[model samples]
Target: MANDTNEFWGKQAEPFRAFFDMQGEAMREMFGQMTPQGLSGAIPSATMAPGDMAEWAKVAGELQRMWLEFVQERAQKDMAGANPMDPAQWMLMTQSLAKQVPMAPLESAQKMAGDAMQMWQSVFTRFMAGGDPEDKPDLPRKDRRFADPAWQDHPAFALLHQTYLMLAEYFTKAARDVEGIAPDKRKQLEFATTMLVEAMSPDNFLLTNPVVMKRTIETKGQNLVRGMQHLINDLRRGQLTHTDSDAFTLGENLAATPGKVVHETPLYQLVQYSPSTEEVYETPLVIFPPWINRFYILDLTPKKSFIKWAVDQGITVFVVSWKSADASMKDVVWDDYIRSQIEAIDHVRDRLNVPSVHTIGYCVAGTTLAATLAVLARRDEADKVKSATFFTAQVDFEKSGELKTFIDDGQLEMIGKLSSEGYLDGRYLAATFNALRGKDLIWNYVVNNYLLGEDYPAFDLLHWNGDVTNLPAKWHRDYLRDLYRDNKLVVPDALSADGTPIDLTRIETPAYIQAGKEDHIAPAASVWRATRHFKGPVTFLLAGSGHIAGVVNPPAANKYQYWTGDSSAASLKEYVEGADEHPGSWWPHWLDWLESHGAKKVPAKGKRKPGGKGDKVIEDAPGRYVKTR
Candidate 1:
């Protein structure tokens, strides 16, 4: 009976051994087909290229190493009975391996043929483009090491490249298997690891191929040109940054100085139209800024600062410099921010004796200002504010784009975990933003400075981007959950800071909404939606450039083109109609609008000194907190 059972088992093993042999044969055949001519579907009777021979040797060496490792790992697994492939797993693995088995040959052939073509193309282009022989044109800009001229004639380069190509093919095949495996059971990782090890074989780096070298040469050449262009562009921006300082600093200096006379209104005081002024309108202006960033982006260094321009034009400038949330104020929320704006307006009213205030809200601060207006409207205190300005602020979230990707459930959970500590550290906030646009700020610097051997200059915007601010945990949670993720701001019956559901329609103030044509964060369409909710007249201005550049517009740097004229009341539709408009800054247009309605008088030298309002100077203007991290 025992002899009969052994015979039965041996017979079963015969078929399994035969199947394994066939699979191995298929793999060998695939590897053999990696010759350039074989891959190109043509047979070459001529001798093998010396470079191709070198690549084959390198591949053989790496394959031998991988085989040893695989055998050792398999032996360990067999001993431990830890084979992930039990009967069911074995069947699945067999099927998966069967599909991937041909991949190595396919990849080998592809690389061999591709390299041959690349070599021929490089030799042809080098002569045709007609550059100095010494200054060979670079091809692929990314990999500079591949640009060695010796690669064209070196036999080892061709061989190693071809080998690596085959390794890459196998690696890709294995990576696909890994991706297919259940996340819990990463059986494919072992295969992927083997593929990566083989692809990065030391022999692969021994000699660079002509194809790779030519690509490098071309890429390096293009990078050289691009670097020059970037330098020129940076220099121009530097000049603009300098010139912008002159424009904004002049205005800020005047405001900061004791008695440097400018317009009829005192530099720092809100200019309310009295019977004494040329023109009088009921609308008063109050400016709101988030404590997260420096207020100067709205009022950057002189000709650039919109605040200075607005003040000079006799617009009532009640700017709110939000006190940064300190350790003691960890529990501050959306309600607190809104209340601060309300208090600011009341302070301006009590101090300047203005009956109604026009509110200008900047970025996130715009949300609070809008909320304040809604609160006022809810209580029938709309009389307090006559007009409102929203600069790159959103109440609607339908088209929030990448920002939406950021506030998903996982992010909320992470934020919740982080906020368990006191404050949401500001540096983390800055880092998040930096990563969002890392290609330009971080990677670009690495490529230019490290790879291209160039120096990166000090960029003020980059500097500012690095400066981060923390949000109070409660404030961030509420802001994200209530307003951003939930679309509470636009909903008429949504729960708000007050017990009653907030209604934006109650906001009857005239609105001046300005957005950038290329603004990514708050698309003009989102900003335009506010007009639909507000029961008031709306003037939407689409300026050129991105969020920051659009808002901190300088008249001197008329780099941006704007859309204007009697257009439709709709935001996006008007923008579409106003495309291809002439070049000019949005500042002048806003200035014209304000000047037409602002209080008018001769430049005044009224000796009212801004002595910090007799309050102790606890922190500097723009503040230390905003500049840190």
Candidate 2:
């Protein structure tokens, strides 16, 4: 037992120790070349003779030479112990590396430059002839691409757009060829370079953007003054204003669903929504929304509220509204999350007099719920959960899209340092997420709030996005390291909450897994992989649009689309190939599936009354925790 404990801790601490050791080695090497006298001479002395200036300059030169030599030595060290290569072999290796670039095989910079010049000449000639010069280029349609029509029509804007695309492609290609760096580090470099280029995009700048310039002219420079005011306000507050906060009030407009918090804990508040239908499902449904954002996302507005839709579908719903973590909750870990969820589930089960409850987890919450269920299953308590539903959530992290780039050892170490105060600041996590969709999330706001001087639309979705929540340091660290970095959840005995091994296959409860077709955070493929780990019947649904839009889609809007398939297929590819496309939202389909399952109809209890022991009303619906910054 002692050896096993020592081994576990040693494995956990190995990476950190190696990181510090490398840093220490570098520092020692750096200082070793500097003599005491030379080091002291480099600094400007309080009293010095005129001759000391030349001496100082000479010392500086020597220091510079030493730095260059050190860098060269480090570079050589990275390639040490490798097989020697002839000129031909070296050329072949270089060629092999270049092939990794997506565009390298297609065209060279010189060729692309020539193409750009020809296109520019044609555009200029057309403009001179008083014709529409902005013909849309045959570029691949991408959500991240600039969508302004003027970018194609105006020669100047067109040129700028072309330049941006070319540079982005070049940088991505170069990033792919960055040798001697770790794979994750290379990905981080690629992501950083892409973000930098996106930040410098012409569409984000007042002077370069045609729309902003036209708006400025129309507003008679008043827009600029307003923009300055916005900037000053944001600077003073140390936050980037994302939405017009005055647009929506919490209970009045946003989380207007009729409900009451029946139970409260230090971790979360459980709100039971009043049933709208005369008869409701005998088996109650409880939702666990990701704590990264407020739970109100599920109850955004009546028109788009999932809670309302579920209640109207005759399903009694309970949502977990999590409290934002602070220093006081620093000791909280995954075990705490699991314990709170189990407690909430037990309370709901006892109150409703139901043997089991249906569970729904969204995003990160889905991951947590899966872990919780696994822990329960290990203890022969799996029957507490009647069924499981996941919304755009992934258990497997192998192909977890762009978010994986930020989970490397270096970034995780830095996050560890930042969260040493017991909590990972919510702002940092929010900013990182925003950076993933920089053009739409970050620069769009910059152009609107700082350039056009426009208050963003009071969109409920954006409002929910802006309502960020902090995470306990221990809990978040466990999440990133176990799930994202090491993928421990999928590996047997690799994960646990209360010292009991978790195995996803033990979760035999029927599952309904939903994935967004264009979800950049949790890729559809990654989410689909979760279906394989569960032993019971699984229904995989693919929704149109990205993460937020895909999950928030309501049937009343008659917008977007979804695909349904035989979840028992051998692989995700097989399922997707055989899936039948369905029109409109997947909510109705999901309800139908739930009805077909074990969700029997029972008389609606109308407004919920507190019943469980110690279950007293904390406050009205959309509890105080939702209002936390």
Which digits, one per residue and each the tens of the lDDT, describe model 2 over residues 484-505? 9888899977878877788999
- The digit string of per-residue lDDT tens for model 1 on 258-325 reads 11111211102222211223333334466776656655455554455566566555453445544444
Candidate models: Cα lDDT each: 0.51, 0.74
Give the top-scoring candidate (TM-score).
Answer: 2
Show where candidate 2 strays beyond 4 Å: 1-109, 130-158, 177-183, 606-616
Report RMSD (Å) for each prediction in the order shown: 16.2, 14.5
Instruction: For candidate 2, give the lDDT.
Output: 0.74
- For model 1, the stretches where C-alpha displacement exceeds 4 angstroms are 1-284, 448-456, 565-571, 578-580, 595-609, 612-629
